[model samples]
Target: MTEHDALIFLVALATLLGMARLLGEVARAFGMPLVVGELIAGVLLGPTVLGRALPDVFQWLFRQSTPQKMLGAYTTVGVVLLLVVAGLEVDLGIVRRRGRSAAFTSLLGMILPLAGGILLGFMLPDSDMKNPNQRLLFALFIGVALSISALPVIAKTLLDLGLFKTDLGLLVMSAAMIDDSVGWVAFSMLVGPMQGNSVEFHKLLTMGGLSLVFVAGTLTAGRRGIDRLLTRFADELHGGRVLSLVILLALIGAAITQALGIHAVLGGFVVGVAIGDSPSLREQTRATIHEFVTNVFAPVFFASLGLKVDFIHAFDFRLCALVFAVASVAKVLGCSVGARAGGLGWRESIAVGFGLNARGAMEIILALLALEAGLLKEQLFVALVVMALCTSLLGGPAMKRLLYRAQEEDVVALLRRGGFVARLNATTSRGAIEELVQILEPRLGHLAAHARNQVLEREQMAPTGLGDEVAVPHAAIEGLEEPMLALGLSSDGIDFDAPDGKPATIVFLLLLAPRRLDEEVRVLASIARSVIDPRAREQLMEARETEQVLKVLAESAQRIAEERRARGPALADI
Candidate 1:
């Protein structure tokens, strides 16, 4: 490459990164998903806006072949990393907890949308398909596109609504994970054996067989091998080496899948799932990887969406509106019906529908693949992108409202109820428990001693530590007529045998009446969800005063309530 070309590539990369980050922050400030900003960043820089307004400069910066290649390389790497992180977010254990509900919801969600999309494809004009003669391929592409759900978007929305660790949240995430896994396999078969206008069935079967073997191998033997590798590195190097190993695993996985005729992202995702399932994986390590990927790779990848096609030239308003309506209605009704069939309540089913309806980044990625494969015309691709964005924006607000209606005050409010300890003078888990019990002594008298004994007994059975420097030590007592809690903050974390290997910095001492077992479980779940966000957890860890901690929790609760009220009832039609 010429020196001139290299210089232009560097400048373009810097500009794209800057614009994507700035816009992403703007999207988050407005309570939208980060992808919205990233996509818009691409649009602004693409032919639709910047290129149109400043033709010469835009042409010089992006129209050059070298600059395009550089941008493509960045996005390719970024996409692999993004997929790996998305896979890591999937928790099969959570899916198992919901059991039939997640399975049924995932199945119905895929079927109805697949049918609707295929029907819509047939309904479109020959002009709407990039390869008019290949109607089956186009129809299949549309079906796969509509059948998938975006796990990252759904998970973030659930977290924002303070339901990330709840039964409903787990069900939604697990269903989305299933949809993604199935959708990718279907996509592999659809696009892997394309030879001009024809698809070779024998080649498709070969690719399908390879993909199944890859998935099975990754989940079983591959998972065990990666776990051992990570453990050995983590035990010795103890710091950045583990991060390097994780990235290396993603690269290896991407290479294997790409060579096997499946997309490279699938490989990254499968490896990420294995990494996430590892028993020795640390929360701090996970957090570091997440922050880096979310800040750097994700923004660049999403922004790259705009660089391929001009939204203005590719968009057909009527087609865009129609496609959006079909995708949203089909998913909502199908998922809602499935959830109800699985024995969920009316409101819960509707909430699940909204959660799953979020197409977000995954749909955009699939649409891009179909466009590249010549299965979809430019207008149709733009329509799918539009549909994805609209559905993504809709899901979060809708689910928030549904959750708000069902929201009630709980033991979490004890942060505000005045049993807050600004500092804990304990270095061990047992000592922390004793300190918390003493805080309750003034009110409970001799009952405090009994509560301490009960909590210690429970701890012996299993640690209450939920990782992320948080623990909930609770026990039911005979004399208590009401539930009580003491919130303790420790600047110096205590040893609590947390699953993630993090020390306990924030502890909740909970006491419930003997018969209120159900309430005790619910309260514990609520606390877990509320503190899942790293930002919130950090705030709790750093607060100088007890009231400051209360303020943080109160503000989050208030934000959710206000947003829910503003949106009113979360209906399918909306």
Candidate 2:
């Protein structure tokens, strides 16, 4: 490339990054997914709008084949890296823990969606250029589209909704991850014949064997070798070497998968998952990759998708409507049935169904694959894309409402059971013990006005600063009018000498009457469990006034209580 071309490339790269950041911030402010904004930016810059208006300027800005190809190549690499990071974040062990539920939910979700999509396709009239066989391929393509769920997108949504650490979220995430992996394998099998190549059983077996060997070898030998190598590199090199090593590994992994029958992304993701197990490696690698790909190359990938989306040619209202209906119904029916069969209540079933319905990056990738394989026409692909966007964008809010409603019902039921008392969260900068004293002082302070009753003694003890910039302080208070609880958060983190040596920004103070102390302690433990969540912590910190804090705390308390209740009452003594 010429110097001028290099300069132009840099300029375009900077512009893309700036646009992505700007749009992402805007999206966050509006409570929308950052991906949506990035996509919109792409559309604005693409041939559809700005480029068509000022062709010359656009040409000057983006350059020609070489620059475009360079950008595309970079974006492809970014996607592989992104997928690897995503895979690394997933906890595969959750699948084992919830084996029965995961298996049931995943299979039900996939099979129902696949069946619905196929049925819808069969009902559609023939296109001008498409024959019956082509239509069958289209049906299968739609089936694949519906059957697939974007695990990464759903994970992000769960985190955003403060559900990532919840039992429901944990089960859903594990099942979805397993489901995606299986769906990809199924997709490969389905598309194999369409590649115009004879089914070579030997080759397939060889590939499978090789993949197994590769994964096992990487885990056993490669990881240790890489760890040693990274340590050495860290000691030897100054700055860019760390980043270079990560990129090299990512590229090598991608190359290996490309050489194998499966795509490059599979290898990249496996490598990421392996590396993620190492704390030092995962943290450094995540930081480096996030700095490079998200800040620089990711926008281009989203833009490329928008640029290639030919809405004019692919805008069939009827087809789009049909795809939407099928996809939505398939997800709702599949997940709801599975959850109900698992013995979940109606509300919980609906929440699970809606949560599983979200589709983003994975859906787009599947549609692209189908289009490349000639299984789906432009119009069909566009319709599917619209369905994905709708499902992902709308699912979060809908699920939140369902869950909150269920929580309220559970709270009312628990209150009626006669074992529970009033729930309250106190907001104060004072320490947990001091806060508890203050709470008791209003009623019981008179008892120790001049000569201390020593009724409400306070202890500091150990702090519970659970690493991600959060802390929990517990105290055993003595004299109290009645058993009570107070929850408080500080904008500035307070020093509590936690195990991790981090200061506590949030505190949960529990006040209990000696008679009901045991039960109250259990409730306090439950509240602590709920507050430890990173998203919930963030939300609590963001809350401005006492009322807002109470509202958020109440919602959290209700959700936790409902989830516990959903597990059903324990058996009585025989």
Candidate 3:
């Protein structure tokens, strides 16, 4: 409340944010996630490195001030917003479409680690447990902690590896989505009991029931209502107004959940899911909110972790290693086995397992919450953070290496026999993807359904509609020797959510092989460039036969070749 406190809080905030951001950018440059650098920043600024080296300075900044409480309130908002972003990333529709594979992956992926964590919790000596009396609670916390996946990190890793739109990527993403959903729900339910409530059998049972209802209601009724509200205000909700609305709803949701004896993060998460599910929601708006929250609030939240604990004192290498080993083995094996059961190739299945193994920021957030709630001790919290950082570092490179292979090929050459659908009867995106996959069934065989799921999954991530009535639904598949291309011409023209709001008459379903990211980009560019001219598009549209469409494509390819040649070999990287 004093001016001195305010001055210290402001100074501390500035230093933490500045140092964290600098390191985050440095981490990005080195191909690591921002959290890795942020963690380092925390260790350096907190009691670990800084306190040891500069005791007086650390004391003056932290010991003399009552800024920790104020920082806690600020970080609470930061965490709420972060969870909202996490919720926005969860696409329930993708999980639904993934169906059996996702179900199996999520179920087994969750169970193994959860069981492993619980067993680990029990096996550990009383010294590790914050309270030996609440061993069950501690065990359950560990279980939930180990079970979840960080959707943001997984998605980013896939994107960086150019697998975000691939069949393999979709499988990993869907499985993670389910794991996160279930894990968070479990965590929310346990938060109340772990914080202070009686750990009686009856109370836990009641909490479990309430949590289920809360999640179910939020996803079903709340999601629909939020969709309607966004639709009604789609005109007014833009720019600063939209940003304010997101913050407002997140706070309200957090408050409600907190009042319900659950963690406030649940409310924010549910609100995000609801807002995100709206068909009317713009990608631009989502990006704005994501950027603002992450760039500003996220750094503060992560940096504040160091101030709360002495990492050097709390860290137990044996325990940390044990947690990491159990987490990695359990998640990888469980997800891989389930993926194999669901018909993925052994290589692709294992890659999915690795992809979903990344814990990232989610684990840190969970661990921090449990520590603050008195459910976890500093030792376990530190171990969990280290585990998260290590797994995040491992997941991407391992998956990339596992599925590596691709090359540039002409779009025309990639097209298979009988791949052209003269008239597409389907109007909806879902229906169109299925129809295209059915055409691919002879060659793709069992993969037809998988292909369909990935295409739909990619579509949900972003609209594939290129302007001038051309739309491409595509994904790069693992273990593919070559790209697969199919064409569907819709006379009625189907909406593909293009920026121009134009329905696509020329729809191409393209499946690429992973690893040749440059080749993939060139292929997409080549396709988009084909219909760039109105005259060419008009000519292609008038042609009733497949040969006519081929002619246009061939001509477009010639033009592209000419352009590439003109650009000279020096510009090849571009």
Candidate 4:
């Protein structure tokens, strides 16, 4: 409130943000997650290093409630935004596609680690718990902490290992989403009713009922309404407006949960899931929201993790080791068993277990909240963060050590029965996509709209125009069993915004099954190589009939297959 306090707050924020960003870049350069650097920045600036070395300087800069409060406000909004971004990664359709395997993996994954954590919690000294008598609450807190998966960390790991679109990658991601969802809900139930000075059974019961209603309404009616609204305003909502709308949604969601005594982040997360799942939210818009939040706001919050706790003074190696061992063993065993039950081979299942073992940002966030809530001791909090960082760091390398491969197919061979659009009535890109989607409607059935939207979303990310007289519009659709292609000929030509400013006379609507990143890459490569040439485009446009189009493509496919055979298996295969 004072002028002196205001000046300190501004200067301190500048220092934290600058240090965090600098260290984050350093971490990225060293092949570590940027959060690692950001956390380090906090550690150096906080009590761990700076306070010990320069006590007076540290006190002068930070021993003020006004600065801490100002910083807290930024971190709070930052965290809520981070949660929304995390929710966006929760693809329910991916869950459906992976189905039984994901369910089994997530179920056992949560159970065993949770049990191990509870046992570990009970065995700890009475004085070690934040509240000596709240054994059940502490145990439950530990259970959720160990059982939860960090989806963002797991995703980045999979991507780094080049397995993100493989069946195993998709499987791990799906299972992790389930684990994250369950973990957050369980955490809220444990913490929500205990917000006041006293904990009561009636309050817990009330919180439980309210939580169920919130989740159901959000997923069903809230989810549908949000989708329709976004669809209606898709054209109008851009850049600053979209960013503003997302923050507004996150805040509104946070308010609802915070009022119910649950953490505000859950509201943002639930809203994120709804918005992210909507086909109307283009990949471009998603990326914009993601980049801004993660870059600007996320570092500040993750960095604050270091500021709050002294890693050196509070760390109990014995306790840390015990927690780490129990969590790791329980999670691996549970997930591996579940994966096997879900029909994966033992080796692949084990690898999947390791991949999903990463606790990452989610664990750190949860641990901090519990610590602030007086449910976790400082040593326990340090141990959980250590475990999360270790698991995340190890997951990618572990998956890389294991073999990862997906079945590859030739796209041209699938045009035998259907997927051939000889002459298109639509002269615009959007109309072309709609017409093609309708042609494949019988096959896609309920997923036709989903297919169309995904294609449109991908298109919006980057124009698919191949720069000749050819354009390939494609998307990987969830639940689609196989690759489908619809070749549409436009005599008047349609503008696809190609690099060379050439209008496309031949358009290929390619639909690929989800979890086939390799297949998608190969098919696109084959199409670009075969049809992007001037002569090939002229031939395709000249022969606009279905039979002639098939003949030309079939020949091209044969030639391409022979060339690939001569060259041997690609580097990706190896």
- lDDT measured at residue 214 in model 2 versus the true structure, 0 to 100: 67
Clashing pairs in 3: none
Name model 2 segments beyond 4 Å from true: 59-63, 118-141, 188-246, 277-292, 372-375, 406-468, 471-574
Give the higher-lDDT candidate: 1 or 3: 3
Local accuracy by lDDT, each model: 0.79, 0.62, 0.81, 0.81
- Residues 1-574 of candidate 2 have per-residue lDDT tens digits of 7787677677766666677678866876676766777777766776666677887866776757666667767777877877666656555456666577667778898899989987877787778213446665566666877887877678777656555544466667876876676665555444554454234556556656766766677656877777677666655643476667666787788788677666676677667656654434533345555556655666666666656655666678888888888888888889878866765666767777888898777787677666666566778777777888889887787766666532222221221221211222323223333544454455555532221222212222112343455443333234544444444455556554343445566654444444332233244345554665566667777776655565665677667668768865331100
Q: Between candidates 2 and 4, name the one with more favorable TM-score.
A: 4
lDDT tens digits, residues 1-574, model 1?
7899899998888888889999998887776777888889999998889888998988898889987888788888888887787887776666665678888999999999999989988898887877777877777778888989988788777656645544566678888988888887788778764436866778878878988999899989999998887777666745567778888999999999888778888888888888987866765666678777888888877777787789999889999998998899999988988888887777778889988999988888788777776677789889999999899888877776665554343645765553877898888889988998888887777798899998887675435676678888877787987777888888878877665778888898888777432354356645765675677778887787777877776665556557658877543212
Worst 10 residues of 3 by lDDT: 565-574
Better of 1 and 2 by TM-score: 1
Pairs clashing within candidate 4: none
In model 3, which regions exceed 4 Å deviation? 196-198, 405-462, 465-471, 475-574
Indicate the residue-level lDDT of 207 in model 4.
73
> For candidate 3, lDDT tens digit of each residue in 88-184?
8777776777799889988999999999989988898898877888888888888889989998899888766656655566678889988987888
* Candidate 4 RMSD to the real structure: 7.4
| Candidate 1: pairs in clash | none
What is the model-wide C-alpha lDDT for candidate 4? 0.81
Relative to the unseen true structure, what is the C-alpha lDDT of residue 272 in candidate 1, on a scale of 0 to 100? 89
Q: Write the per-residue lDDT of candidate 4 for residues 1-574, one digit (tens) a residue.
A: 9999899988888888899999999888777888899989989999999999998877877778888888899999998888899898887878887789899999999999999988987888987877776887787788888999998899888655545544567789899989988788778878863444445778778877877788778988998998998889989998899889888988999899989887887888888888888877765577789889988998888888888888999889888888888988999899999999998777778888898898889888899888888788899899988888888887776665554444334545655545767688998999999998888899889999999999887676445665566778888898988788777888888877664557788888889887554566456655665673455567787785677876777677667667768877532322
